[model samples]
Target: MFARVAQEDFSQQALYDELCAHDQRSRAGAIVTFTGRVRDYNHAGAIDGIELEYYPGMTEQALAQLIDKAVKRFSLTNAGIVHRVGRLANHEQIVWVGTCAAHRQDAFLAASFLMDMLKQSVPIWKKEWVGEQAHWVAAKGSDDDAAMRWLTEDKDS
Candidate 1:
C-alpha cells in the first residue's frame, strides 16, 4: 500500500507503470486507477486556481487509513493514493487513486471506494479563487449521497 500527500506534481503514466509492475510481481490480475484534475470552472465561475491546505501528519494518517480500508473491504492486493496540496493551477492533476486485485470487480470497486472516502473523509481543505475573490468549498450533498451507498447493506441483497 502507498499513500502520501505531495506538494509537487505527479506523472500519471509513471505512477500507473509502477502500480502495474507491483501488481505483476504480486500476481494481481486487474488494476484500476483514477486521477482527479483541478478543473477550470466550478459553481462560482471560471476558477483561476486553487490553494489546498492540510495538517501534515494528520492528512497522511487519514489517507493511509483510507487505503487500508479499501484494500481490506475489496480484497485488493495493493493500493496507492497520492494527493497534491498547495497552490494548484487549472487543469493540473490533484489526486490519484489506484487499486490492484485478483479480479476486475474488486479493483474497480476499491478505486471507487477510495475516491468516495477521500471526498467524504479526507482532511484537506480547498480555497478556490474565482476572479477577485476566494471561497472555501463546502461539502456537497451529491458527494455525501454517493458515499452513503458504501455504508449501506450490500446492494444485491
Candidate 2:
C-alpha cells in the first residue's frame, strides 16, 4: 500500500501501472481506479481554480491509514492514493485512488470506500476561486450521506 499527499501533480497512468505491477504473480485479477478533477463550476458560480490546503504530516498519516484500512477490509493486494495540494486550475487532476484485488467486486468497492472515507475523514481544505472572489468550499450533505451509507453497509456485512 502507498499513500502520498503532494503539491506536485501525479500521472494517473503511472500510478495505474504501479498498481498493476503489484500482481506480478498474476494473482490479482482486477484493478480499479478513480480520478477526481477540479470542475469548471460549483454550486456558487464558475470556478477559475481551487486552492487545496492540508496539514502536511497529519494529512498524509490520515490518508495512509485510510489506504491501509481499505486494503485489509477488501482483501486487496495493493492500494494507492495520490492527492494534489495547491492551487489547481479547472479540469486539473485533484486526486487518484487505485485498488488491486483478486476479484473485480473487491477492487471496485475498495475504490469507492476510499473516496468516501477521504472526503469525510481527511484533513484537507479547499478554497474555490471565481473571478476576483474566493470562498472556502463547504462540506456537502450528500458527501456525508454517502460516507454514512458505507458505514451502515460495513456494519451489516
| Winning model by lDDT | 2
lDDT of 2 by residue, 25-137 (tens): 75898999999999999886688999999997999999999999898889989999999999999999999999998999999999999999899999999999998788998
lDDT per residue (tens digit) for residues 1-157 in model 1: 7899999999999898877777776799888999999999998568899999999999999999999888888888889999999999999999999999999988998888889879889899998997778889888999898789888846222
Model 1 segments beyond 4 Å from truth?
Answer: 155-157
Worst 10 residues of 2 by lDDT: 148-157
TM-score of 2: 0.94
lDDT of each: 0.89, 0.90
Q: Best TM-score goes to which candidate? A: 2
